[model samples]
Target: MTPGLRLRTAREGRGLTLERVARATRVNTRVLEAIEQDDVRAIPPRPYGRGIVRAYAAEVGLDSDAAVAEFFAQFAPVPEPVRPAPPAAPRPVRFRPAIDRRWATVMIVVIIAVAAATVVIAVGRRVLERRSEPPAVATTGVSAPTPAATVGTAAPSATPAPPPSSGVIVVLEATRPAWVAASVDGRRALYRTLKAGEREQLKGTDAVRVRVGDAGAVRWQVNGRPPQAMGRSGEVRTAIVTPSTAGSTN
Candidate 1:
């Protein structure tokens, strides 16, 4: 039986009026009426509407699970037709130009000569400068006094520390365009229209579940975690990410 019908029948069987059920369940009378009448338009999308129906069913002593199942079944999506695959074509071989033998040898010789000249000039300049420097002497104009050589100690090395472990920020875009309820690690995150690039933050261990219509659902975990098939409303595409730990300069 449909959820609306089941709800209606359960209420009537219990000898309860719509207003009585509404008041007890804290659901609006209009919404309750809609559920009984199978007017799904009156309720919001699942799991928002699902919560309302569940709440109403619980109050009326109806089987909430059965009602929800029926509701989803009624709205369950139709499967798309599959298309035949196209025939694969053989890949064309690519050819690259080979170097001219004579020019290649000349180029190598020229490069070697240039490099050797540069090295010799650099070393010659350094040796000339060292030979030209005068030896250290006492400040007073007299016989040069030899100063005792002091042993120099090396300074401590300063190494940069590694960044702290700040968890990921995932931006999940819904493959199917629809209103969706997204959850991270089983927490009620948000119920909003799943636009492209919609983002959410989750710890490294958290799993992601997106319910896309009554037809499509997908599950993927953050940081190489296993994938799970979630209840579908529509198609879902997941992207893993690590958020920046640095504070914004702005």
Candidate 2:
């Protein structure tokens, strides 16, 4: 039987009313009903929801640990390992061409000068030959080749990246002051107050769950997923998180 059914069976065996348990445990009557009905979506998510089951089990004299375990068994299997974001592609290199313009202009002027000199020399030689003087023997030798200039430009630089987390990564960015409790793979990670603009990262290889004292005060994300507002300001909420589920307060 499912954890919810188990809880309901245990509660019925004890002849406890949902109202009686709610008053005893200080839990919501609706929540107690949801738990007995196997309506996980109605309860918070695992981990946090597991705590509710523990409290309920204790009130009804059941095995809290086993009930909590059964609640978490519904989640996906433990994650393998954390995966890092892919490296950014290298930036393209482009020459400005501005610095080489002066050199190009100078080369053009020298070519013009060389051509003019050659034409003048040829005319002079023809005139001397016409005057009955032996034509000056033309000397032919290759001019040295120009060396290629190298431009020294560095590749574009990138900013430092954030450190990698080794398990399912859950990020909580608090917009306003609030209380937050979180767990990963049933291991408690954080139970602290988060001031406005504060961020907390939690890790879970199996499953992660969180409870917010004030929903409107925080936004959350998992494994690089889009950030989601927890709820209206002052609303308390809970939800299960996995790499795939991304943990939604709704």
Candidate 3:
């Protein structure tokens, strides 16, 4: 008997209907019936068809591998058809704006003019600042006092020392660009960014408080004391100089 007949006979011997076999094997009832009736065209093609028959045979107590061999011996496998590939899409074109020669020339000239003006202003400002600053005092070398015209002339009495100035005197010198804000005696004194090599001196009766951005870029001194660094670079620091603390370094 054919493989399908053998499967159907085995299933019937076990009291299983086609519908019951279909449910157990997960195969459609119509396909199971077609297999039983030996209708090769009704089943799937080739390996798939053989696989379905194998499952059906195993579910009904027949040898699955042998069943597949026998079914394919009677109905050979059919090859899948080849399909043509779809065509590729076309690429898009990009457009750029047209440049005008007149506009380009005008822009170049404007940029040059602005740069020239900036340089001129910087040079002029430096010149004016130098003119406004106090000139350095020239000192002649020390010379021995002239011999007294007469032996009776006694050496001039020693010059007296100057009296101490009252009030706090704070000096800020910037080695680089730094933001500084200061107050003296509880009133605003100066609040601005100092350019490189700039110096400011402020006086206060009671106290002088100063705040700086870029701490290490600026050095400060109080009451003619030695200069001190505020902190490391890029650090923000504040200090209050009073008459009592001005002389002590801690």
lDDT of 1 by residue, 53-126 (tens): 88888877878887677776776564685433332433343433343555555667766776777778768776
User: Compared to the true structure, candidate 1 yields what TM-score?
Assistant: 0.34
Better of 2 and 3 by TM-score: 2
Give lDDT per model, in order.
Answer: 0.55, 0.71, 0.73
Residue 39, candidate 3: how far off, in angstroms?
82
Which ten contiguous residues of candidate 2 have the minimum total lDDT? 129-138
lDDT of 3 by residue, 40-90 (tens): 866654455676788898888889998888876886545684433332332
> Which number leads on TM-score?
2
Off by over 4 Å in 1: 78-250
lDDT of 2 by residue, 6-28 (tens): 88888889999898997787556
> Poorest 10 consecutive residues of model 1 by lDDT?
241-250
TM-score of each: 0.34, 0.36, 0.34
| Count of residue pairs whose backbone atoms collide, per candidate | 8, 0, 0
